[model samples]
Target: MSGEFNLIEKYFVDQQAQRSDVVLAAGDDCALVSAPVGSLIAISTDTLVAGTHFLASANPRWVAHKALASNISDLAAMGATPAWVSFALTMPEIDEIWLAPFCEGFFALADQYGLQLIGGDTTKGPLSLTLTVQGLVPQGEALLRSGAQVGDGIYVTGLLGDSQAGLDVILDKSNATKPFASELEKRHYLSTPRTQVGEALRGIASAAIDISDGVISDLGHILKRSGVGAQVEVEQLPLSQPLLEFVGSSPQAQQYALTSGEEYELCFTVPDSREDAMWQALQDIDCQITRIGTINDDDKLRLTLDGQDLAWQLSGYDHFKTN
Candidate 1:
């Protein structure tokens, strides 16, 4: 360990640093946590680099917000209520002008979810941010990808591919300011983690996952983990009004919508018998839940469009792909 400001010492290492359920924290040697007797812990981490995750020139405040929201989405998948988070920021230099607004955006969402920032580290390096978030659920009640079963109905929250549509606009900059383009851009920047929706889904969803690496790929995680297959109806895949207007009904746009990354909507599976109640519950909260597909016992993932089977051109976004 280098002697330069120890992260544990400056930020984590002391009883005075305790924020919530962190019974013991950094400084000594180990961190201790306490959970309510009937509660389970849900933890997740996400990292965003300047050039990799967002444009190098992206606003610092939005960057901070996305970094936290992405990790919070994981907790949502587990149907957990967020509790705390620790941030690790590595930047080339310290700029108060940037950090101030960044912290404001970060804390604003954290406060909204009642999450406490317990500890974190700041270092000199390229612009990168990582957040480790924790949440709580009733013991043995956390949702899991492995819980999905055949014959389950597939559902997705909100729309898909709006973020990808916004990204395309930013990259090409071809179109003049259009209403759809503006909405897509805003959705790409200000995605809300479905914490309330997730919590409401507890005991209802058989399996769940957040769409981070596009719908096709993220859904594959659920199918693979649950040892089940799924057949999605391309026509039923929910596309935001902005996305439909921006991309139109072109084949290429449909491919991108199916494979583009950074869509943070929740995809879940529920039994048909429970569909009515589930939809009612989510609708009560004003969340638009769309049925896009159904689970299958066959070991093949398939897609259908307008009552006809169609081969998907792409399996979904992969970070390693040259495309």
Candidate 2:
């Protein structure tokens, strides 16, 4: 097996997606990246374990893709433009075959966002990946969870619950034969971070967060931070065609839409004054946006279906909670 430095040099160094703001990149003690004048640096890191995050038999390419994309999603939620990333990879053994496709997946998404790989480390361990992504946003203009105000419309970008349904398919938890098996699997492994949508929402959205821990859990973040409450219309939750086909409009689908994690869609609030401007700003964004609820003064979250209260017993994914 190749040594750590040799593997790093071979797989990660001198890769594509170089940025002019990066003063120094990989192969250094530490990376040096510059933030443009009047801009603030946004940083977020995520760790993905082999069994807990992805199946042990999962493809290395998709694993790398998910690891990096999830972290970038955090930056997007802050309405930042992704600029650079540093990742640490731990493996049971240095298998060049696995390392080969992993870099392919990592750099493929990096190139898409023009992200420069600044620095990272390689170690031998229980097969895990951690990526730290950095982005730039205008000072005093970064969207935040605490900015939501009472009466602001709660909105979400793209279809929700697909990632959870895809996980069910991956784990063989789905009872019925799934016709859109590949589509669901793709949604699970290839969740797209709403970077462009986040950029469009910079000035329009009062508060924003990426839906990694399901809608209820993530939106709860905004509510808690803003010291406000929200009432989400269950009927207004967006369901993709594959998810609708998989489970129809039943409560099961609704539950998934409410509590499924790793969706990576942007859930944001728009002040009533900017509601029209918000629509116009996001009209040309690739993903669709839905107004599913409104902020309130009560400081609690409520759910309703067709103007009637809907009871939900399930909670979002929790890493330390014992069943």
Candidate number with greatest TM-score = 2
lDDT of 1 by residue, 74-160 (tens): 999899999878778887776677776777788778877877776667678898888899999998778899988999998988777
Report how far residue 200 has shifted in candidate 2, in Å.
1.1
> Candidate 1: where is the Cα deviation over 4 Å?
1-33, 175-179, 250-253, 318-323
**Which ten-residue region of model 2 has the weakest summed lDDT?**
314-323
lDDT of 2 at 78: 94
Q: Model 2 residue 314 lDDT?
A: 77
Would you list the C-alpha lDDT of every candidate in the order shown?
A: 0.78, 0.86
In lDDT terms, how accurate is model 1? Answer: 0.78
Q: Per-residue lDDT for 197 in model 1?
A: 85
Q: Give the true-structure RMSD of model 2.
A: 2.2
Q: Residue 103 CA error for candidate 1 (Å)?
A: 0.7
Candidate 2: which stretches are off by over 4 Å?
1-5, 173-176, 319-323
Which lDDT tens digits does candidate 2 get at residues 69-173? Answer: 898899999999999988888888888888888899999999998788888888878988888899999998899999999999999988888888878777774
TM for candidate 1 is 0.88
TM-score of each candidate structure, all chains considered together: 0.88, 0.95
